[model samples]
Target: MSGERSGDRTERASDLMQLNAMALEETELSLHEDADGRGDPAAAERLHRLADSMTDTARDIADRARNLADPVPERERR
Candidate 1:
C-alpha cells in the first residue's frame, strides 16, 4: 500500500544517512592516520577523494529523499 511504500522510502533514506556518516568517519580516520605518518600520503589523498565523492552522493540522496517525502507544488513540478 501507499503507507508501506512510504515506510520503505524512509528506511532507504535512513540507510543512506548511515552510510554517509560511516564514510565521513572513515575519511576522518584516514586523515588522522596521514597526520600521524601511519598512512601513505597517496592513499590518504585517494581516501579524501573517495570521501568527498561519497559526501556528494549522500547529499544527493538526502535531497531526493526530502523531495520524495515532501513534494513540490504542482506549478513547480514541471
Candidate 2:
C-alpha cells in the first residue's frame, strides 16, 4: 500500500515537472518575441520577468520531483 502511494506521488511529481518545463519554454519564446521588436521595451521587460519567474518555477518543480524520486537518507528526510 505504501509503495503504491509512493508510486502515485512520483507520477504526480513527474507530471508537474513536465508541465513546468513546457511553461518555461513557452515563456522563453514569448520573451524572445518581445525582444525581437514585436513588443516595446517595457513590455519586453515584463516578458523577461515572466520568463524568469517561469524558469524559477520549473526549477523548483524539477527539484521537488528529484527529491520525491530519490528521497534523502532517513536522518535527513523531511
Candidate 3:
C-alpha cells in the first residue's frame, strides 16, 4: 500500500468497506438470545450505525481521491 496509486487505494478502501458492511449484515450478532430465534433489535441498530459510518468514510475518501485526481486551481479553491 505504500506504493499504491490514489485511484487504486481509493478502490481498495471502498471495496474493503463494502466487504465489511456485508460481513456485518451477515453476522450472527443479530440473532436473538431467546428461544424464539428472532432478530435482536439492538444488534441490528448497532450494525446499521457501523455500516453507515463506514459508508460515510468511504464516500469522504472517494471525494478526496477525486479532488486529488483533478484539483481545483489555487485561486479558485474555496
Candidate 4:
C-alpha cells in the first residue's frame, strides 16, 4: 500500500530541504562571526564543518524528492 500521499510527501520533503538550507545559512553566518569577529577559531571551524554537512544533506534530500516526483516513462510502464 502507498504510504504518504504524493502531494503531502512532496510538500513535506520540500519543507525539510528548505529548513536545512536555512540552517546552513545561519551556520555560515555564525561561522563568519566566530572566525572574523569573535576570535574563536575552533568554534568557527566546527560551525563551518556543520554547515558543509548540512549543505550536502539538503542537496541529497532535494535529489531524493526530485527522483520520487519524476514520472515513469511510457516505455517503462508496467
The number of the candidate with the highest TM-score is: 2
TM-score of each: 0.54, 0.65, 0.50, 0.53
Residues 1-78 of candidate 2 have per-residue lDDT tens digits of: 465776787778777877777777787777777666644678777777777787777777777777777767898865
lDDT of 4 at 9: 77
Cα RMSD (angstroms) for every candidate in the order listed: 4.2, 3.3, 6.5, 4.4
Model 4 Cα shift for residue 14 (angstroms): 5.3
lDDT digits (tens) for residues 3-35 of candidate 4: 888778777776776676667667656665655
- Per residue, candidate 3 scores C-alpha lDDT tens digits across 1-78 of 899988787666666656555554444333222313427767666656665665566566556555655657889976
Q: Which 10 consecutive residues of model 2 have the lowest summed lDDT?
A: 31-40
Pairs with backbone N, CA or C atoms under 3 Å apart (clashes), candidate 1: none
Clash number by candidate, in order: 0, 0, 0, 0
Winner of 2 and 3 under lDDT: 2
**Residue pairs whose backbone atoms clash in candidate 4:** none
Please list all clashing residue pairs in model 2, or write none if there are none.
none
Choose the strongest candidate by lDDT: 2
C-alpha lDDT (0 to 100) for residue 53 of candidate 4: 74
lDDT for 13 (candidate 4): 71
Predicted candidate 1 versus true structure: per-residue lDDT over 9-77, tens digit per residue: 776776676666566666766655564563577866776676567567656766665665566799998
